[model samples]
Target: MESRFLGIAELTDVPDVAVVVDVMRAYTVAAWAFARGAERVVLAESLEDALALKARRPDWLTLKDGPPAPGFDLVNSPALLRGTHLAGRTVVQKTTAGTVGALAVKDASLVLCASFVVAGATAGLLRERACERVTFVVTGGGGRAEEDLACAEYIARRAGGGAVDAGPYLRRADASRSAAELRQGVREGSTPEDVALCLEPDRFPFAMVAGAEDSLMVLRRVAPVDPPPSA
Candidate 1:
């Protein structure tokens, strides 16, 4: 059976599985931090809460920060994550879209953190695992942005799924035509090269497991022990 969509607004609807994205920065930085050897990354919806968590667990090696989308701390930009050495540490990150949406849908049977950084590989992993349904929570900067939607489209397409339509949840959400958004992302220093990089689709097959003593969720490539039948 093929996978299908629920609704964007139904992010917290408790589906079989869901992937929360903050690829521009929150999720992106999480990936970079893990790649830099950080032990794990914790995604928080609030700066104060993340800070408090870090304070409570200083030994966990937590670094509290996230994207700034107005009142937020950091913006979701790949440029920010570059050259950061989080090796053997943990991070407490707060993002406007990715974090909020993720928290909203925290009740899912399986919640996977994703973005362009791990999109393709994530698709394969989900397919292999055979999740009955998968939802993409776009975290639209208090709504939903075109960049996130486009990224979602690519992921949904890659998964060889989309039996359910999510347009209803996106009715009030803002989106740009893929071409225009891509161009703007490039002109704004986001860079077409970065887009290409994120488009690698699951370059990292890492999954974040919550509730572990490891406060930080690092990207660890997952090897499917039971290989699926090749098409």
Candidate 2:
């Protein structure tokens, strides 16, 4: 098995299995949504697309960052989502980094969304697949996306049969620019629980695997088969 790290710009170069990391909030919110019983998450390229999808499927919920869009259901904050009941419902999610990066990978046989919340389960899923080539797509662009990079490295190390500690990576994510932005969002009346929720490593036991349905990228939670024994 081989693992390579790439940025959002290299989405086209992803290999057999691609793990897209967005530790600040995107994938973290996704993980929480799934845990809250969301049926499926549709990846939208932009806010316009998300709103359009919602208009078409009136029952589907719309989730996006920043201010709420017209006809949108919720903002992209896991803390807010924690209180909502999403059972048996579909969600249309449009994020600047995570969903866009995930939808842009056209070649990979399998694409998984990653964050500290689901990192261990994601690495477990990769190890179970035993893929020949795996690429970690850091969706927050590269140099400035410390949280995403740290998550990629942690997943790679765990997928490679290494008994690595997640403490260092979590610390790195806590100090990232993305984390700072989330903190600022909290002060501005955004959910104060978001920063802590995003940084909580291994909060979920399943991986968010991306698949196509009707030409749309959809994410669903998948438990790793025969997960590695806990350290």
Candidate 3:
């Protein structure tokens, strides 16, 4: 089995398994949402699709950009959803990179979303499944956000059987262009706290798997299987 890291622009051929990483916010929010007991999180490819889904199902929470709107219950902020009760509830999210990258890999046999929260388990799952070709897609904030690239590298390291301390990488991400902009907008909506929260590595033990549910890409939690004890 071979694994390769590719940015969105280089996604020419789909692999047997595709892992999309958007550590700055998107996948981190999903991890936190599930940790908070959300029934399931749906990944919307665009704002329009999220709104359209919300229009049809008023019970689902729609989270997007620019602070929580009056009618919207959430945004792409992990800190924002940390205290919210998501039990028995579904969240529909549309983000700039994560969801788009996830939906773009339509040809992969399996699709998973990765972040620092699930890095170890994600790697374990990949090796367990033994896929021949695995691709990690780094969905940068613009062309190649610094944070996402760092995250992609970190995930790749863990997947390739290496130890990773997220501290240094997280610090690098905090200094990235995306993190700087998010900090600059703290008063407007984006917060440094959210950026801080998303950088914590292996915070959760479960990996997020994405699949089509009706017209939405729904994410479900998958616990990585433990290996047999060494002889």
Predicted candidate 2 versus true structure: per-residue lDDT over 43-111, tens digit per residue: 998888888888889999998877765788878888888888999899999888888779777457999
Candidates 2 and 3, the one with greater TM-score: 2
Off by over 4 Å in 1: 1-12, 59-77, 141-143, 161-231
TM-score for each predicted model, relative to the true structure: 0.67, 0.93, 0.90
- What is the RMSD, in Å, between candidate 1 and the native fold over all Cα? 6.5
Ranking by lDDT: 2, 3, 1
Flag regions of model 2 displaced more than 4 Å: 12-14, 186-189, 229-231
Question: Per-residue lDDT for 30 in model 2?
Answer: 87
Candidate 2 has which clashing residue pairs, if any?
none
- The CA lDDT of each predicted structure is 0.54, 0.83, 0.79
2 against 3, candidate with superior lDDT: 2
lDDT of 1: 0.54
Residues 72-140 of candidate 1: C-alpha lDDT, one tens digit per residue: 333344555556666777666665566666666666666777666666555666767776567777755
Clashes of 2: 0
Q: Write the per-residue lDDT of candidate 3 for residues 94-137, one digit (tens) a residue.
A: 88788888988856888989887787777777767775678888
Residue 170, candidate 1: C-alpha displacement in angstroms: 19
TM-score of 2: 0.93
Order of models, best TM-score first = 2, 3, 1
How far off is residue 198 in model 3, in Å? 1.2
